[model samples]
Target: MFKSLLISALFVLSSQVIAATATNIAESAEQVSPLLPGLAVPNIELKDQYGKTVSLAERFKEKTTVLIVYRGGWCPYCSKQLANVQKIEKELADLGAQIIAVSPDSPEKLAESKITSPNYQLLSDDSLLLAQKLGLAFYLDDKTAKIYRNKLGVNFVSLEGEVKVALPVPAVFVIDTNGLVNFQYANPNYKVRLTEDLLLAAVKSVSEQ
Candidate 1:
């Protein structure tokens, strides 16, 4: 009876912590405080492009991970960045690193995005749960959200059908097999991104450590 009570108490505490984190999401992209180097990457489970659950921690355990957080498939800048990464996917793999891209698109949308490459994995974070936990989630302003939905035809629905108006500031994190972030780069400007050359250099540096 005591052990069961302890388990229930721990569960409730964790739920409260997550709720607190969710409530603290930044109001704008510029205000987001992305996770920094030396911090342990959050071990959250997110749906892959095929709707299969993939754990961030499990992926980290396999090898060094290059985690790319993008706004969505609807963003041209995001697409370009993904393509640039593809060009150096082999180089990264040769250095014993793997790449994983996460975005606020559902599994179906992820499939439609056609951003997949054989060398890397794409995961869906429609609810922005992982982003929030990493301090990288921000609420899109009403005007921008409306423009995206009405003009751009970008669907904001989550996997459970609820609308999500949050996006992750475009960021890249190099995390080691132990899940410790080795380097990070995040910028609120949607048009600007870390270059493929810099990303490859970052991965190479992490692999040596």
Candidate 2:
């Protein structure tokens, strides 16, 4: 009977701690300005996998931009989503849209990632500035962050000694040449992703307009 009570008490304590941490993360996330339809997308400069500087506005100046924001390559779900996007690359191109995938990975890590699409641009958002501007950036709870660094080998710090592990919610945005967002999909659940069919429909609808 005593052992049972001790286990129950421990479980209750653990649950409370988890709840509090989740609440804090959610509260901090509330400050992010979520991108909505018709909002002008922010123009952010990012480094491509090839170590070249790229401007988001200039690269897709005349074409519809299909922007995909993901966590770094260390995330299996993110890698799978990116690969799925590549599988539909031709369809996206046929709709006159260019796909760009952004993540907090460094340029070196971005290049190492095998997720590739023809004419696809992989931009490094190591500073997470773009994610912050879009109101998609969120801080991982302390325990989760520690696990990522210690177990997952995802050190979200730069050589300059800046820690930047806070990440964007995996998101997708279809933006017209006018810099206005036409479609956006963002979920707090990192495991879920926008479907290819939905993305195609959105691109077609916006390109027609």
Candidate 3:
């Protein structure tokens, strides 16, 4: 009887340890990706350069959408990426893909950041509603925020004149007509970007499928 009881107690202790480890693993895995491919993306509302409200889902219905989320126009990296995207705009359109660039910039700042093409829609996410829904928004450190406002002259403020609280992770998502994410590129490093060649390849794959 004593031996049997010891075995039973050991088994119970092992089971408890296993359960605790499993719970820890699950909690650790909760650091979700900002955007996951093969999932339906957030259908958040945004405004165009002209301040006209637009629905992301509505755009998906018309064609395959290449969604580019960037920092504000003040970032040279973002500006270069925008220009590169414009160069590939026609080719993507031929494949029934449209590029929409969304930034945390206000509509007024968006106007200043125009890429000189009506085909590429520059949308504003000043409220960060879309970013938060996608799990991509992160708050900057107080020191960095102060530098952006003071030295950089970027003044990361929303249209409502509230100081900027959060910024989206620079990312690109290729959405299918069904509003599902087909491909995505997200980088925590601000200087890096998804190459146009890779973007074209993703679009081609979607088009063929």
TM-scores vs. true structure, each candidate = 0.83, 0.80, 0.78
lDDT of 3 by residue, 4-72 (tens): 999999999988766543310011112425768898977888998788999999998988999998877
Question: lDDT (CA) for every model shown?
Answer: 0.84, 0.80, 0.77
Q: Which stretches of model 2 miss by more than 4 angstroms?
A: 1-31, 115-118, 153-164
Per-model C-alpha RMSD: 6.1, 12.2, 11.5
lDDT of 2 by residue, 127-205 (tens): 7778877778876667787887787655353322334346778899998998889999888888888999999999999
The predicted structure with the larger lDDT, 1 or 2, is 1
Per-residue lDDT of candidate 1, residues 86-189 (tens digit) = 88889999999999999888898888866566559989887778888788887778888787778655435332333556678889999999999999999999
When sorted by lDDT, best at the front, the candidate numbers are: 1, 2, 3
Strongest candidate by lDDT: 1
Q: Pairs clashing in candidate 3?
A: none
Ranking of all candidate structures by their TM-score, best first: 1, 2, 3
- Global lDDT for candidate 3? 0.77
How many clashes in each structure?
0, 1, 0
